[model samples]
Target: MPRVQDVPSIPPAGRADDGGALPPVLDVQDLKTFFPTDAGTVRAVNGVSFAVREGETLAIVGESGSGKSVTGLTIMRLLGRAGAQIAGGEIWLTRGDGNRVDLARLADADMERLRGSEIAMIFQDPMSSLNPVFPVGEQIAEPLRLHKGLSRRAARAAAVELLALVGLSDPARQVDAFPHQLSGGMRQRIMIAIALACEPRLLIADEPTTALDVTVQAQIIALLRALQARRRMAMIFVTHDLHLVGDVADRVAVMYASQVVEEGPVADVLATPAHPYTRALLACVPRQQRGEKRRRMTPIPGTMPSALAVPSGCRFHPRCAHAAARCIEAVPALEAIAPDRRARCVRWREIGP
Candidate 1:
């Protein structure tokens, strides 16, 4: 194994040797991931496209079963080789050599080589992701040892340092404790340590802060943002917390019915949403406001349609408040509503902020 610094130098996303902006770190195009069941194929991800610039955070936000997590898993190829697989599109990642490789087409063995060294994922539910019997330190060290070729003793030492970096108390003692022995926050920090062990160029965080309390979620988000800046890494943050994306993500990709419905800067999308689904989601979050009576939460009128039987034309048409006759007959492409902003609604112009 070689030091991370020994890798070939790649230009940042927004700079070039020729005085122009460089390519994005990760470019996903028309991605589709499906899982075949006895009943039907589950279109977990459908025609999703987005990009992550170096040192930028792109949040994929949606309701449960809307396929935010599946998109992340598809990028990492974590769904494995057997039943579930990518049915279409390219996941183009910029190599350290300044060249691009399509992860979607890489061989399994070759993809495994990139898993920890070039790309890492911080999974949700540390208790389920981490080994129950093994000490958390050992679990964290496995990636370091396997990817970095560190000796057991050296890996253990590095594990303690990583724990401390993530703000775990008594790193030495914590390293030796099992996953069940730690608090939810502590376990999450351990998961972060493991994901950061190799200093991956692209980090995929799949709802890592979901289970933690408000305080802990804030801490983890802050830590992740700090780490991204310190390491200058590109990140894809998948979560259902539309409220949290503004704090950590540079951009937002709103998913619905397994497809990207909107994409734009965090402030623009959250403050003045263009899509009906995005607008409805914002209305649903619990926020603090001084009022005579608490404001009512306006949940989206209908539940998301099942992936096995997505609605015709626009996937959100059945639930859209402004659904026109054409909406149910013609699928709308994600079109530019502003500079660097896009929405999948045909009536995006008429949709108020």
Candidate 2:
């Protein structure tokens, strides 16, 4: 495997280099998103921070309820309907024109204008995200019409081209088809087409491969890589599967109980995880060596703690095998464990390789 380049601690605002030395397209600092429920305030995402440079893919992976999805939604400003609020933090996005703006502080009108033009998101379920009443072509053309001010006829023509761009066959005919008329993979392709219509600088793909079979999932992954490379766009790939992260992401951030426990290059983190939660996650992935007996996968011992009442000290202490007494006394800061790696565990040096 090739050595992964180190991501700068503070990314500058500009274009990317072929050697992965460019500044971050999106830099999230101490993001805290909360939802006030009837029972209590749900801290869906707490003090989560990461960055993705132009043409780079950052995968946020964890079990369900770990706040990976919420973090992505928060970045897209799509959690307003869910009654979620940004209690604190900054979401800095560098525009295509090299202007940096704090998305958290951007006005609603400004954010709305930036959504499809500067940043786009591909949701998990196409059926729910796509309008059944409208043709797929019109759905793809909506962003072009609204953001690019394209005429109806030209937008429709571009939609067909987008469908074809995403590997859909006979896009001219399929463009007129309703959401229900297509297969799951095809619908997903249509969603990708709509997202890429405006050629946004950044894309937030929230579990875009859900409900997809292995074959179709591979195809979608390849298509996304091709498109991202061609457009030189940054992407946040959110998923629960760590196995998928190795295939797609340049860097991986492991989240647990609304916080990031570990983050580093995909190769280094997977080979030598610096956090207990990250180790437990890798253990759960089933793997077998050639000419050897298959080992039984060891499931992570406990469920993730409730966000409303997260455990003190180390949030992952309850499920960590090597947890110690000090883990319950006070919370551990996400500190540097290696040259380019960070882990939220006080005993990382004692416990890690």
Candidate 3:
């Protein structure tokens, strides 16, 4: 965790990119979030920027505690108000009919209304997110009841439908069961059902398959893809798995220490990554091929710099194999490396893979 003072803020007025017209769902620019800690303020999301277009899956990939989940929480307006401060930035959210809203500036009351109904989220941990005391049906129905003002009976009926839609068998009977009665996968499915209660235009799925088995993970991924195609909903899929991102994401945004290191179309970014950090990450993912004697996976040399003690220049320079003296002196800007691609490395061009 880098200290607040050490992490440089991205210019509030971000680059005027000709990435053509903005996406008709979510646009975030220079977003920064900090938490007040006893040691110092921890810069969780540092000048991160990206957009999720309508009906497209934009994946944010990073290691644990890389501010991936924090970015999603910030977008959902779930950040704590008292000690957790949104230091700076603009979040432009577009509605169904090409209308745009500055989400960062919206009041709490306004944000509350937009959440669950317009923009929903499936958090990382289903067990922690679901209410232990409430029956699963009521818990799922709560969002629909509040957002749609459905009658209790109607909401309960709809909840069963949602559960069934997520592939739960005997949804009507299972609805009356409590969270403890369900398996981990079932609880995650319930969370998805609750998130989709109102058919949100955008879904932020933050590591939605964290605790599931490999088979269940594949099922959940397929489920999300199916739902996205059927509903035409924009999504921000946050996960550490590069392999998983390639499977479903249209575009990929790589994050390290609360900052975006590389971003581009998923295929191009994965096939030919420009950032050293991105390359290092990809090298670690296992590939199955005959005669492929397992080589030591190239881990990004050192551990991630603590958010509280973030390096002065490029935060990743210390771990970056291509680090130069200049990297220690000045923070690198996320400059365009090619069309529809950007990287935060001064030597990206010079240091070819």
Provide TM-scores for the models: 0.91, 0.93, 0.90
Give the per-residue lDDT digits (tens) of candidate 3, residues 255-341: 999999999999999888999889999888656579978876666677888889998898888888899999989889999888788
| CA lDDT, every model vs. true structure | 0.88, 0.89, 0.86
Query: Per-residue alpha-carbon lDDT of model 2 for 1-353, expressed as tens digits?
Result: 11112312233444333464555799898999999999899999999989898899999999889999999999999997889999999888877766677788777777888898889999888899999999999999999999988999999999999999999899999999999999999999999999999889899999999789999999999999999999999999999989899999999999999999999999999888889888888888666669878777889887878878899899999988998999999989999887678999999988847
- Please give the distance, in angstroms, between residue 328's alpha carbon in candidate 3 and its true position after superposition: 2.3
Pick by lDDT: which candidate is best? 2
Report how far off residue 281 is in candidate 2 (Å). Answer: 1.2
Sort all candidates by TM-score, best to worst: 2, 1, 3
Would you list the rank order by lDDT, best first?
2, 1, 3
Instruction: For model 3, name the residue pairs that clash.
Output: 1-306, 1-307, 1-308, 2-306, 2-307, 2-308, 3-308
RMSD of each: 3.8, 5.8, 5.8
TM-score of 2: 0.93
By TM-score, the better pick of 2 and 3 is 2
Clashes of each: 0, 0, 7
Q: Please give the range of 10 consecutive residues that has the lowest summed lDDT in model 2.
A: 1-10
User: Which run of 10 residues does model 1 get worst, by summed lDDT?
Assistant: 2-11
TM-score of 1: 0.91
